[model samples]
Target: MNRRLLALVAAAAVLWPAAPAQAGPATPKAPIPVDTYLRQALDGTGLPGLSAVVTHGDEVVHAAGYGHDSTGAPVTARTPMRVASVSKSFTAMAVMTLVDAGKVALDEPVAEQLPEFRMADPRAARVTVRQLLDQTSGLADGGVGIPAAEATGSPAEYVAALRSGHLAAEPGTAWAYCNANYEIAARLVEVAGGAGFGQYVRMHVFEPLGMTGSSVGGAAADGHISLFGAWVARPELRAFGARGGAGGVVTDADDMGRWLITQTGHGPQLVRPESLAAMHAPSKVRDYAMGWGPSDVDGSRLLVHAGNLFTYTAVEAIDPATGYGYAVMTNSAGLYDDTYEVLRGLVALTRGAEPPPAGGQRQLIELVLGLVALASVGLAVLGVLRPSRRRWRLIPPVLPALVFVSYPQWVSILMNGRTVTWAQVTYFAAPLTVTLAVAALSGLVVAAAHLRSIASAR
Candidate 1:
């Protein structure tokens, strides 16, 4: 059965939707070699599996999976994975649907729908729904307050806390990345739809786009099929509260492929072409829009977002002008770098362009420096083995490395308040540098003492 399934998957890969013949003749269909690259990338990242889809013009460039399933089951294009924050785009879409219906005004203050919402700054009451969509909400999302684990409480309670949280800056002053604002907008979605937010999305959004495998915050009642072996039933994954508007989506490559098509205005499933253009339209925040971020990828305006939820990561992007897009989801977060590369490659193939390769002097310098630093520290630590252990010496090599990595990310954090780049630098610098410095210094001191003792004996 597995072999047959694999064969079927391979066949589907070749026979997937083709770009129109009007897309400038046949253009000689060549094997993109993306599957092989994806496999190798996944191997290095320790990601259990990945599913990706690419569309060129109207053609489905590729839609396939590589590696073992999230649950060690056979991975197919249909394997459901939590899309994490990527669901934010869908949430924005849902809210915009209400906008289309004239059920909610984008410029209206959110306090009109949820009267209980408040913030530390009285000016926060003036924050409009459009501000939230654009991520200009100046709420305090800093410090160790927010948990890294999955949120398990009622969505209402979670949103209430976010609404009542501190505001470090007035709304529209600067961009502040916070999930709370979206959760609040989601509450508005509930009231506007007169149904559970997830159900409304399912009925209007997912079902219409043929995203049957997509669910906000969880998989279906039948559970998700693993890419390698068996069905891992996730009742909790299915038990999403009202937070579906923020980060509660479970979907696969095929479904997302359909979404990418619709996003580029190739299909008439969701909103109109004008609305999509509006969604992709840039805001004051860098690369930010109504629900998506805009950037010039390969010389064309592209809408993109990457989702993160603990071990899982997903990214999706579309270039409406080129009628090309890509969706990539990984079951493990460790493969983030690989995921980015894979997504880039798929997009390049669809767009019929090769992206600039990543091998640069800076990357080489960092790689060599990292290795040399690691080896030096490791050797020093080996000489400092004490049974009871004692005070350790500190090394200076870490200071340079820390400064090198932290400064840019710190600048980004200071300028944009987005934790994505900020958190990356912080996570890689602080603990690693501190630990290695201590270890190397202690080892160097122990070695010196041993050498002095030998000299005295001689």
Candidate 2:
């Protein structure tokens, strides 16, 4: 999954009050049945498992989970699930701590600080730490060694491979959401903080907010995708090599509540308000800050970010206007993202508006594809047993088969040139992939039978 797609959350025209009411006794909003809404989402969306946390200031208003994972374990707020690219915000917090300690200069050229971040592009020499955090370094996914799969082995090897990476634009000239930005930022924290990236995050980010013993990596739940109205579990095709900041952080709703509290300017301050402000502040080049993006929900503003992996996806949002924070994580994903839909409903709940009902889109689409596949198989079987006179029609059916052959290329084009591997298409687009395969294979079988019949007639 291209994690960049996770941004903008709902394209949300989410409403927020202009300011906190003052000078009168506040009428407390009645408690909303967050559980009822979440349960509805789980059943309607056909998500195998869902977990979420809602926070108002430092208080956890709600934290719970629904359904069960592939292992038959009922998902709960405490279950470690993959938050995917949401981990970037945590990584940004870790680096900001180093910045406070005067160890990492935000504007210093990355090559000067670490010396390992060399690139064939001379413009890479000007890439700054702040630019890396804000995703304006112009380093793109096309850069050498940027893909998590390509950078295997230890953290040192990952950084070493970036020596020949190419930049998409000059530093600070534009904003592009490249995972490599966070990967390099994580490596910098390791070198500057004198600890591994995971340990550094644990020490500075999680542990400070009273979340002790929590680290980056864990045994994340098996992710699932919808196929013919059933959930099919799929293993992640690639391990985030060295597990940098970009993706592959296993956290739960319980931990997420505490993290959100810190984000919304409550609980213990991990970084000073000024430092946190930097994380939330939008870059001049784009609305994206370090790991967060600014969005206007009507007249009010909210800081939002999203996470997407093949099997699992997540989204996080903070309403600075209301000091309300939300985190939604799911253990499954597909071409359509139900995870963000749930988050949108949660935001509506915060506004005292009923969360509008949503679900069934994925199931409906998959069912139609399944029927088409069945019809293709049935037609081909009939054609083989009782041959066709016009064999020319068989050739056109074979063309759909080429899509299965060039599956990755087709998906990459759809994703705006982002790389989509063969194994990945099976998870997010399984039903569509199955339908195409059935149609193509049936074409070949029918063609062969008709060709034999033509030879006999001759």
Backbone collisions counted per model: 14, 0
Tens-digit lDDT track of model 1 for 1-458: 00011111232234234443675544455544766656655554444577888876556767887766544676678888777677888888898888888887888887776676665567778888888887787664562123331144655655655543567667777776666667777778888888787888898899988888888766422222221112233222212322456677889988988888888778654776667677787667555886677655556567887765544567888877678888888664321133555666666665556543321222232343356556666655554443212223333423444554555445334424433333332221222333344445545555565554455566
lDDT (10s digit) by residue, model 2, range 143-240: 65455534466566777777777888889998877777887888899999999988888778787786652467666757787788878887765656
Candidate 2 local lDDT, residue 75 = 91
TM-score of candidate 2 on Cα atoms, chains taken together: 0.88
How well does each candidate superpose onto the true structure, as a TM-score?
A: 0.71, 0.88
Best by lDDT: 2
Error of 1 at 340 (Å): 1.9
Model 2 C-alpha lDDT versus the unseen true structure: 0.79
Number of the top-ranking candidate, with TM-score as the measure: 2
lDDT values of the candidates?
A: 0.60, 0.79
RMSD to true structure for each model, in Å: 10.5, 6.3
Pairs of residues clashing in candidate 2:
none
Specify the poorest-scoring 10-residue window by lDDT in model 1: 1-10
Candidate 2: worst 10 consecutive residues by lDDT?
A: 7-16
